[model samples]
Target: MSQMITIELNGQQQPLPPGSTVNDLLAIVGSDGKSVAVLVNDRIIRPESRALHQLQEGNRVELLIFAGGG
Candidate 1:
């Protein structure tokens, strides 16, 4: 089994396996992949960072959703 870490997502605690990418979490949470911003450890993660980013233990992740306006 792969290593795992616990993180907080949208105020909830969840366990994520090591080596998991941002895209993985989005899928796990059923994110639509649009109008959403991801912040890891108080830093905004760009699209390029998704594949390169790795979740660490005690890390805090915030997923913010933005609404479309006219």
Candidate 2:
């Protein structure tokens, strides 16, 4: 069994499996289909890099989603 890691997601505690990437988290949270801006440790993570950015324990992540509304 693999160990789970804890991360601060959008100011809340989120538990994720080890080796989880930014893309993985987005998919898990059902946000993969939306337009989102991801930040890790205060640095912006581009869309093309989401799949390669691995999330670590105690890492702080922030996801800002864009919505279309008047």
Which ranges of candidate 2 are over 4 A from the true structure? 67-70
> 1-70, model 2: which lDDT tens digit per residue?
8989999999999999999999999999999989999999999999999999999999999999767779
- Cα miss at 66, model 2 (Å)? 2.7
Model 2 TM-score relative to the real fold = 0.91
lDDT of every predicted structure (CA atoms): 0.83, 0.95
- Model 1: residue 56 alpha-carbon error in angstroms: 0.6
Backbone clash count, each prediction separately: 0, 0
lDDT of 1 by residue, 27-56 (tens): 788884675799998899887778778877
